[model samples]
Target: MFDLSQFIFFVIGCLATFALVCLLFPHLFTRQKKFYPKRVITAFESRMFTRLKDAFPHHHILAQVAFSALITHDQIKMRNQFNRKVTDFVVLDREYNVVAIIELDDPSHIGKEQEDAERDAMLIAAGYTVIRYTQIPSIRQLQRDIR
Candidate 1:
């Protein structure tokens, strides 16, 4: 029933309506994403955190701490290597001084000996005690190793 001009007008009207709807509710035309909080530490790390807390009742145990938080280098290149790398657990004395940089070597760390050593070496060079644990240590072992 529509001639060429009428058909063109109808199409234009439909497009305008669609454009208006999109402008009013742009989210309807786009993908909706609902973000939720994710766990900062892994399940194994969570277990370690709990154990560390139990082991050192008077000390503070900080998990997933970046090296940059504790150490800084004058060279940008040197900083870049470890600035963003995270240490598993940073044991702190009652006065909040860093006691040691602790790394839990679960199955995931099997092939990363050289890399781990390098990371440890960096901390060691900074005069920090770096301890890597193959498994969760008993309270006595933790106390002994930390001392």
Candidate 2:
């Protein structure tokens, strides 16, 4: 029985089901907004970043840079267990080669000493200098260290 009425009812039913699903889960059907505002660096880190920029005008002072950005994905597993760790500041030369990794030591970092040591070891093994500071170092000291 090739009923045109049955075909019409089937199409209507499918459309109704789809409309119901979309109404139930509007987010799934709607276009999502992706971009959001975020702070690149904390207040304390911002001050340090400013000092770093002033001190090393020629060098690149990257704040809140990710470890994954610096190292290849394959190298990450070879280096250490921590995944996607970020350094407080990564100083790079004019050629974009890493010059040094600077970590700001505060009271919050006390419990994570072992993790910090492992990260430092990995960075040093990769031939980059690692400097930890509780307080901001003088511009002269930074110049001496980088040199």
On lDDT, the candidate that comes out on top is 1
- lDDT by residue (1-147, candidate 1, tens digit) is 759999999999999999999999998988878789988898888888998899888999999899998888999999999978999999999999999889988898888899999999999998999999888888889889997
lDDT of 2 by residue, 62-133 (tens): 887777666653674563554567889999889998889999887888889998998888777667889998
Models 1 onward score TM values of 0.74, 0.68
- Residue 131 lDDT in model 2? 95
Leading candidate by TM-score: 1
Clashing pairs in 1: none
Off by over 4 Å in 2: 1-36, 73-80
Position 64, candidate 2: lDDT: 79
- Candidate 2: C-alpha lDDT: 0.83
**Local distance difference test scores for all models:** 0.91, 0.83
Which residue pairs show backbone clashes in model 2?
none
